[model samples]
Target: MTTTVETIRKGRKFDQVLEGARQVFMADGFEGASVDDIARAANVSKATLYSYFPDKRFLFMEVATTECQRQSRDALDSIDMEAEPREVLLQTGQHFLRFITSKFGQQIFRICVAESDRFPELGQKFYSSGPAVFRAEMAAYFEQAEARGQLHIEDRILAVDQFGELCKADVWPRLMFGMTKVVTTAEIDRVVEGAVETFMARYGV
Candidate 1:
């Protein structure tokens, strides 16, 4: 596929806006971030910024959605669909850990949790686009594994939920409150191993 200049420029501008918005939102919260501040941070004129995002709310939503989509895509891309079930689970877990620990991911999670009440639609959008999609993908993976006789999950949905719970044992709490230190590769490997072992015990070849 040929790449167009407009496409490249749009992508670059989108990333610039997202980065600026992330900083502003993290520093000032959703209510406090202003279009002026975002434009200033992005080194773009207000008119230029507005050309890309009509309003602050739209900009914030785009920033959050971009981060969420990036993380979700990373998780999906990391998994090798044709690999063994355990390998797939481990790869998924590792990528998930990386995503949650990333700077953009941390800021977006905080923004969502902090502004969820005021921006109910934002939360819904995020859920629909991110975790909901991720869960569905995972469920499909589990279903395929069961069909292939690599596993025997009675309920793919529940299995998907369990997998999330296992991964979140370390990831969620850390993201929510920074209650734990950043997860290392070793820690990710350990968590993945334990998760895989537990999952296999319940449903394996």
Candidate 2:
């Protein structure tokens, strides 16, 4: 599958190589993907690929990191910080968790999980670029909610992290293991509703 990384902004050739590498890596796990494969997919010479990315690992890191950022923006950018806490949280939770449970999301997570040990930087990159970005956005949202007297958040960062995990509590684990694949609107609503209820119980004004 073609990895969607619309948020990645780099030199044309550089992004081209990354896009190629992302497709190859997704199709053929990290260990299976080769520089030649990426070069061929990108229509650049091996030398050109290496010039942009010193090594296959670095290329993979960039693709994975960009993927994280892309997914974060895909879901988080639409959040209305000025909205009510319940509306914002519920909306964000629904979109975020739904994206996480998607095929593309599952593939990226698997890539990180599988190659993280061989390349520990992958985990750090994934976190710093993806989840951390989301957490920061959520924290800002929570801060706004607190300012509006809609939520009681003494630690906005921590509270948002909790809220993020709460959204994943019921759905995301099953996703990682391949136990569940299909996602209906009913399932998303159930998960988001539960998370919203629990979060409001603890932090509601």
Candidate 3:
């Protein structure tokens, strides 16, 4: 029987290993990261690390997926669900813009794309944990807003997707295309506020 990565048993040091992997992956690209370095960084033996993760790809995928999930969850937690549609959307758009334009997020995206041919699962994991998670959260919020008559949306999912695309208008493409290295606060604010305004104009009640 083949041992799947998911079947690996996570001991008490599971979180410790994940934290260590995240640090190393951030400092070094996926191809540059080594198991020995990961083990040393995690303060775990090679045996222990192997016990938890059979392969380096699996470890990297878990780290990326976990970080994406945490980012979305943290952003959702900070949002005021009861706030007016414009206020809530502004907050959400800001969070989305800042995170996607961050160094870690960019690295994860690049790594997933670069390694996709060899490891298609990495990209799938990233999408499910990042974009899909964000869409689901935003969809729920849109449903709530519609219920309160703050938004008139015939398709909540489509609106959620549109809002995401709107938030990515300028800054995200610039960063992705290597036209800009640093995402200024001003840029984030510009894109986020524009997205909110566009969304509210279309959907606000």
Clashes of each: 0, 0, 0
Candidate 2 displacement at residue 19 in angstroms: 2.6
How well is each residue in 6-115 modelled by candidate 1, as lDDT tens digits? 22235457777778877897678677888889888988888778777655665676677766777788778867887889889888877776676665566566666766
Candidate 2's displacement at residue 178, Å, is 2.9
Q: Write the per-residue lDDT of candidate 3 for residues 1-205, one digit (tens) a residue.
A: 5454447688999999999999898888677789999999999999999989987877887898998888888888888888888988888888888877887778777877887776677788778877797898788888988898889999999999899899899788889999999998898889889998998889888
- Indicate whether candidate 2 or candidate 3 has the larger lDDT: 3
- Candidate 2 vs candidate 3: the TM-score winner is 3
**What would the per-residue lDDT of candidate 2 be over residues 14-69, giving only the tens digit for each residue?**
87898899899878867788888999999999988876766565677687788778
CA-only RMSD, every prediction: 7.0, 5.6, 2.4
| Candidate 1: segments with Cα more than 4 A from true spot | 1-37, 40-43, 47-58
Arranged by TM-score, best first = 3, 2, 1
Model 1: colliding residue pairs: none
**Total clashes for model 1:** 0
lDDT of each: 0.75, 0.78, 0.85
Which residue pairs clash within candidate 2? none
Clashing pairs in 3: none
